[model samples]
Target: MAVDDFKAYIRKIIHVDMDAFYASVEQLDDPNLRYLPIAVGGSSKRGVVAAASYEARKYGVKSAMSGRLAAKLCPDLVFVKPRFERYQEISKRIRDIFFEYTALVEPLSLDEAYLDVTVNRKKAPSATLLAKEIRQKIREKTGLNASAGISINKFLAKIASDINKPNGQKTIAPDEVLGFLETLDVRKFYGVGKVTKDKMYQLGIFTGADLKSKSLDELQQHFGKSGAFYYQVVRGIHLSEVKTERQRKSVGAERTFNDNISSEIYMISRLEAIAEELEKRLKKHGLAGKTITLKIKYSDFSVQTRSKTLGLFIASKELILEESKALLYQERLKNSVRLLGISLHKLNSEQNSSELSAKEAAAASRKHEQLRLPF
Candidate 1:
């Protein structure tokens, strides 16, 4: 509708998300399970769902939801533990396919990523065509389905990716940007959470149309720095670039157990295993951070996080295990814990991460080999 909307998105971006990634992998590995409602999370009273298959979603199951509730909603729901290693292997193949078209790939997780193909190795004329081809290659290479969204910018691409999911693709042309956004719910706008949506409703902003009607000053009066963001986003203005080399602020792993454990001894052993896994990730990524955070989720779904900042960057298994146990011991358990995680933050510069000592490299290899596979 306006010159501004068309000017900002000269670059083409695409977001690809694997449909029900972990759950889909589980189903692909076991054909008989494909017909059933599959939930790839934990199957315990305290477990949370990691991913829900299309069948599971029919009964209102979703990722990060409690497994107990999922079972309640779908009585015949089947649960399986996550296999991160297998997922990682598949992700590499998917990314390799992306590299064939463009070198600019930014991974959000093992299951989702954003790619900028404005200038590509293939020199494709249309981003939509690129997205379609990428999705096809991913399915062909991995035997897993992926969905893609093609747009001029990241914001639109991310939203469009969810339009027709499960091995589908959508594109938002420049002419239709404003109209497409106007019909979208304010709740669906990026960064507008449930709390923010409620606030928007109270302020009489129900959809993009409502959000667009508000003046920048009125928005600033309500949402602070984010107000300015909403002002630009409602009009399809996003300037963030697709970065090839992305830095992770944290690296950690957590697991949900089949049964809630109240024993301190068991928790210590589990924490050690988690610490070993974290060290392997840190070594693999060539990262070390100064702040170590321990996350605990209780049987009742309540979560707690305790963090400690050190004077030096540390990524060794022994140090992570030591600090995590210290934080764990400090907490007085009011409930049987179900999930535990350790993440590192305040990462050091990446310049020195690649230069691991011979001993350190050997230790990392051993850690990788000794990983306690959940599945």
Candidate 2:
């Protein structure tokens, strides 16, 4: 296909992300919490913030930061325990709104999703206006603020959503996609985390244009398989689709101790408790796996993972605990342990589900050649 013809096949993808979802829900339920620096998670010494309100963000408080550190950042920060059930209820209400327009909705989490509106039930001529309408409907139904980004594909759409955040939206037109990506900072690229950003800076790839200048071989030499991904995205050529049914790749549970424990005996007890929790989660989903992984986090914040694959799938508490104990003993502790987790992988559901691989999905997407949106 010619370049212009291929561009005509661009999909109308919109990434909708709720603004500080967990924290916002708390503030919405309690009038007093509004406009305050509030975090949704435990307030204990070992507690971690799951989400932070915009007010909290101003003080450098963010999700995953320890409760003690968050408190130090914002002395007046209110810590609210997470009510996951309530959040799930609101997420469903928002998802219902999404279905009213299109059935091609891919939820990233409780607070964010991607909607492919290239062929929507609403038959809306413009995805930009459709996104605005959807956000308005969400606010009316759930009393929550959502931001959206409309673009040709999922990657750009996801990135654009963050441009005007906390109840705003942005649309990147086909004509503007290349220029938009060219000047964008490498750090702002979706998959480029702090470590990758530093590496890219070291390689003098500070902008999308700089990334575009590198050959595929050079990118692969530096970034491994991800190099090909960066090379494609910088030119606005991502082809990932909005999958409606996402599979669970793993199930696990973990906890951080109030004080780091160094004793192997104590760690074994903690592992037993964690294994029981993992078993409950597995049974709740009627799932079992063949691979058992033990995750260890040291006091220095470094993490290590040990995994063992069995010939048979296991989900029972006894089996999980047994496997976890074996993996835990497989290696010696390097430092004082701050956290431990147990996860089940190579799940039975994965074997049963006929989900397409990334390559297959990309190839399938190419079969559809007429996705011309009015935009």
lDDT of each: 0.82, 0.88
> After best superposition, candidate 2 residue 362: deviation in angstroms?
14
Regions of model 2 farther than 4 Å from truth:
5-9, 350-373
Candidate 1 contains a number of clashing pairs equal to 0
Model 2 lDDT tens row, 1-375: 267754754788899999999999999999999999999995988899999999999999999898999999999999999999899999988988887887677888999999888767787779999999999999999899999999989999999999999899999988888899999999999989999999999999999999999999999999999999998888778878787677899999998999999998998889889988898888888999999999999999999999999999999989998888888788788999999999999999832213324454444344455655556
Candidate 2 whole-model C-alpha lDDT, 0 to 1 = 0.88
Those runs of model 1 whose alpha carbons end farther than 4 Å from true positions after fitting are 1-5, 255-267, 298-302, 328-339, 349-375
lDDT of 1 at 218: 92
Please count the clashing residue pairs in each candidate, in the order shown.
Answer: 0, 0
Could you tell me how far off, in angstroms, the CA of residue 277 lies in candidate 1 after the best superposition? 2.9
Poorest lDDT segment (10 consecutive residues) of candidate 2: 350-359
Top TM-score hit: 2
Residue 258 error, candidate 2, Å: 0.9
Candidate 1 backbone collisions, by pair: none
